[model samples]
Target: MRGVSLIILVIFFCGASSATAQFYQTTTAHVSFYSSAPVEDIEAVSTEGISVINADNGTISFKVKMRSFQFEKGLMQEHFNENYVESEIYPHATFKGEFLEKIDLQITGSQENTIKGTFTVHGVSKEREIPVILNVLDGGQRINLSANFQVACEAHKIKIPKILWKNIAEIIEVNVNADFQFISK
Candidate 1:
């Protein structure tokens, strides 16, 4: 009888451990972009991006509005919307992807993982794989993810005016850091 009871207890604990692996989602996530050039590069920043992450299923969807972008100077901001990004037509960029592998919440602290998803920008969609570091906290109830990746302007059909070609780099680096709270459904 004692051995049987111990086996049942172990099974119960294992089942509970599996059930505790839950994920969260957030729309107020933050994202930013940066470009580098010799002396004329244009650098901008935006924090009004939205993101939804499901840690349990390893799915992520996010979007950012071009109009929310802010540049170092007013003139640059205007030019970015009018000439480069065409904010009036292609107003937003988005991404939908899932983590390549399941993140074990039991490990706690921070762990690096690969995220595989399709990124849409300037009306173009392309598959991309990025490395992300996830910080699991609050007994796996809260999550913070951070990653940096680069995208070529031409891949998204973003054309640079011949006159300002020297003012922007062909490739732009994007940085993402998002905090999410578990959503009970």
Candidate 2:
């Protein structure tokens, strides 16, 4: 009976350890922003973003260097780093949030969900709930996420010159996409 008890205990411990949460992470996530006004259209893309998701708890977080964004015109990029986002002062923009509903991402396919969290830009943080689309691929070994949201310049104290106000939109459309492979511990 003692041997039987020891065997059951070993199985329980092994199962408990194996049931721990798993996470997926990627450093090459893509993030982009677009602003279209009557006078001008502006857009920038950044591939130097890092994203992580917990397959167990549905928690997600993303971070990107402000200077990593690239614009078609050099001047535009310079202006964005110096005058608007002030990359020198606040180097990175980050988002941290948790899923509102429970779902298993290990199953391959697409699922829509909402997440509530805080987004920090220009050193200011705002709580927002965003809708997201998750795509599972590679039979649960890979995952992709996409989210669309809007950010208001005024909300973060981003100042735009009066002359260029019309050239830039007060609200910017932000889009994010990230691909990740499951990391086993």
Among the numbered candidates, top TM-score falls to 2
Tell me the TM-score of each prediction against the true structure: 0.83, 0.87
| Residue 94 miss distance in model 1 (angstroms) | 0.7
Model 2, stretches more than 4 Å misplaced? 1-19
Residue-level lDDT of model 2, residues 10-93, one tens digit each, is 333223324566667777889999999989899999997876677677677777889999999999999999999999999989
Give a tens-digit lDDT track for model 1, residues 1-185.
32343233233322232364454655555677887876586667777666656556666766778888888899989988988788898888877788888887777799989888788888889999999999988887788889899999999899976776677888999988887777543
Model 1: CA > 4 A from native:
1-23
Candidate 1 accuracy as TM-score: 0.83
Lowest-scoring 10 consecutive residues by lDDT in candidate 1?
A: 8-17
Worst 10 residues of 2 by lDDT: 8-17
